[model samples]
Target chain A: MSSPKVEIIESYCKGCSICVEFCPTDVFEMDGFLAKVVRPEACTKCMQCELRCPDFAVKVH
Target chain B: MAFDYEQYLRPGKLPHIWCPGCGHGIVMKGLIRAMDTCGLEKNNTAIVSGIGCASRLPGYVDFNTLHTAHGRAAAFATGIKMAKPEMDVLVVGGDGDGVAIGGNHFIHACRRNIDMTYVLLNNYIYGMTGGQFSPCTPVGAKASTTPYGNPDPTFDIAKLAIGAGATFVARTTAFHATQIDKLIAAGLRHKGMAIIEVLDDCPTAYGRRNKFRSVIDMMKRLKEIAVPIKAAAHMTPEQLEGKVLTGILHQEERPEYCEQYQQVIASAQGD
Candidate 1:
């Protein structure tokens, strides 16, 4: 079964790319410098991306 | 250079930035071991820290480390958990940072019962930025700021957590390194807020002011004063004066912040 999904709200994404770089699995991809959850199912719900994001724009739910 | 914990430790940096024989490194090592035992992927873990010597831990650990502002590890950890919720969050800080300035955050985190582990390194005094007195420096201890001996009483962090609604609370010392790992691993396994206070030796500050000749002497002092909470529970007044309690002080199962948050949105959506 797939792991927990991390829904990334694109408009809220500031695109610092910290989350993209932090996730162990390539769950996130950059779309014009904004973070896109290309593989939400790949998200392990570790929250490393959310925690490290300085903007607080991204919400995993 | 070999494949041991000491091997992973930065030798060039060592002799450690902490004062000679300070217990912070021992506590850090125990934390690493606990992480190893949990089968946590190093690259997947998030370690957060705040200002203070003990808070400098995130930089030393080879993970997704966050070295944040003073006394804000819990606040930061909250954001981390709320956002991802699946990732394990470990907050590391000292008494002054975690309990005093960050005390409010600590209480709120406990009340909310967030799914995270907080390791509080209590060496009594603010050993890093100078021997200043803190909320847990104990009443009557001398510090650079409290030359006449401290007039303010100390706080028992584990007791405070129990009172504030933390689902789990435990106390241990750096000297009990293996037990420290077990406690940390247990906290990681817990579903809600788990506060582990690790008593440490600040030989340069709390020790010197309190009159210990060396770090070993300071450990001896902790040995004499520390009574396992279990043992203390059965001790008579004759055996329990001026004793520290080292064991799980409280534990309870409760709904954690993440699951409750998901419920909130689910209820709102009626889905």
Candidate 2:
């Protein structure tokens, strides 16, 4: 179990969905227009989502 | 068994700003691993970048970093290395910032054989300020600016660096994370200039236009087309179509710019 969590800065997210697709674990969800981290436990802390997000909205803690 | 990634990542900066499935993440991971392997002191390390999607790396990294003007990372890193010869300097940028807009600076850096390492995160298209075609974008590839198809020829960076006088030149795609890590680490230890071209994917810009199903599919394309030098030597022309060679293309030693500059200064008697 990866204790690390992923948090999204909704204010910065431009609805790019880059992180949602890159995360191998499907840790993110589309909350209508924003990227919502529906499952933090699923995150492996790979930082793939963070690095791939062009808008710089997603982060892995 | 846990990897202490936290030690290098800043807490408040949780999450990065890149788009999903962008290959930038993979390259960043490889760079971090390479720095760790080199046993670099964080204080003594610096990462610089120009204005491009890939140039965003310097900000995410928890090191002495500089995000400079477009296509100027090479020049920026050049000045830094010239001032502090002992610092572990790494310059990160995309094909556009590094080669297109900053083409002259790039060639000169290699020509100077300056003691620095350049990790060019080449995603083919310029993913920043819209998906424009870069100098390194392969011919016939579709980008925002190159609607329908790209008719221009691509820049073979490894060969270009070799011709430009870079002492060390290597090419690796984001798919080869471990290999890229080792190559970058080795490049940092090299005495003169080193350039590592990382073939990354711009899922948003290059990907959608090319009709690729997803980013994974784009990465899989690397395996199908990527050829090691050994394999390439045996392959015929017909078998080489669409394939790009990856690995250390060249390595040699020569008098570096800073070393020669010191000699000239000594000869001038500090005049």
Candidate 3:
């Protein structure tokens, strides 16, 4: 299977840091106020960030 | 595809009015996923809500939506279900709207065993009304209305649903994101009245006064307090103290209200 790609929609991100705090593998980091996928390779596609993000900014594929 | 949330969401309603870390958005995503899992026809599904922060959820979803008065979601949903029994009616509302202002309608609907799903988002405060203590607010919690700390006793929403005669009842927190969809999907598939109580968070209004420094802290609290039913059985009472059980709390087969009403019509017509 191909590695999952994670994307954060900047327009929708409210910088809640829920994605940042909840990612078990530390796949995200805050770039200013928006969540940035800092470690794409570590993403296990657990979907914690995408599911918990209140802003609907995170998407994994 | 990446779950295709945009397909379920209404166009141009992107930035929802909920706060950045409010758990209502998480529940909404879960509801969308549940609807998809159940293969509910968007045109045939009617989502109803009352006035509150959580009530705004119906406006964002692409469905037959109804935004009703404060605490009247269950009543409106009942009318819709009775009028068009084929439509899948779902009610969404907050703790205050569901149990406080519309408490009577909620219990009666449960008693009637209507074939509808009610997702009660218990954020513990009236978030839209500026952090007033709600029926589910924990005792001694500070709210805008209770600056000295709330003295009101809280309602165990899941127990209330079970006691009120809902056929299917479940509970989960927003921190357990995956479980939300699972419980809701189960509720959707159930034949009689299904109530899913989501222990949600209100970071802005509830958290600020309650000493939670940030949204992450509030979410962490939800994560810590929820113990799944299977795991809860293994733990001692001391270990489970202050923790809420998460899973299907009650379920039973019962004659649905609409079908029973149909029987009444048949009997009256001498069929």
Clashes of each: 4, 14, 0
Question: Would candidate 2 be rated incorrect, acceptable, medium or high by CAPRI criteria?
Answer: incorrect
Better of 1 and 2 by DockQ: 2
Judge candidate 3 at residue B225 and give its lDDT.
98
Q: What does each candidate score in C-alpha RMSD? A: 16.5, 4.4, 1.2
**Who wins the lDDT comparison?**
3
Model 1 alpha-carbon drift over 4 Å, by segment: A1-61, B1-3, B6-15
Clashing pairs in 1: A45-B86, A45-B87, A46-B87, A47-B84
Local distance difference test values of all predictions, in order: 0.80, 0.82, 0.93
**lDDT, candidate 3, B60-149, per-residue tens:** 999999999999999999999999999999999999999999999999999999999999999999999888889888999999889998
Q: Which tens-of-lDDT digit does each residue in B109-173 have in candidate 1?
A: 88999999999999998888889999998888899999998999788888899999999999988
Q: lDDT value for candidate 3?
A: 0.93
Sorted on DockQ, best first, the list reads 3, 2, 1
The TM-score that candidate 1 achieves is 0.78
Top candidate when judged by TM-score against the true structure: 3
lDDT of candidate 1 over A1-61, digit per residue (tens): 5456565655445554656766788888878867787887777776655543423334565
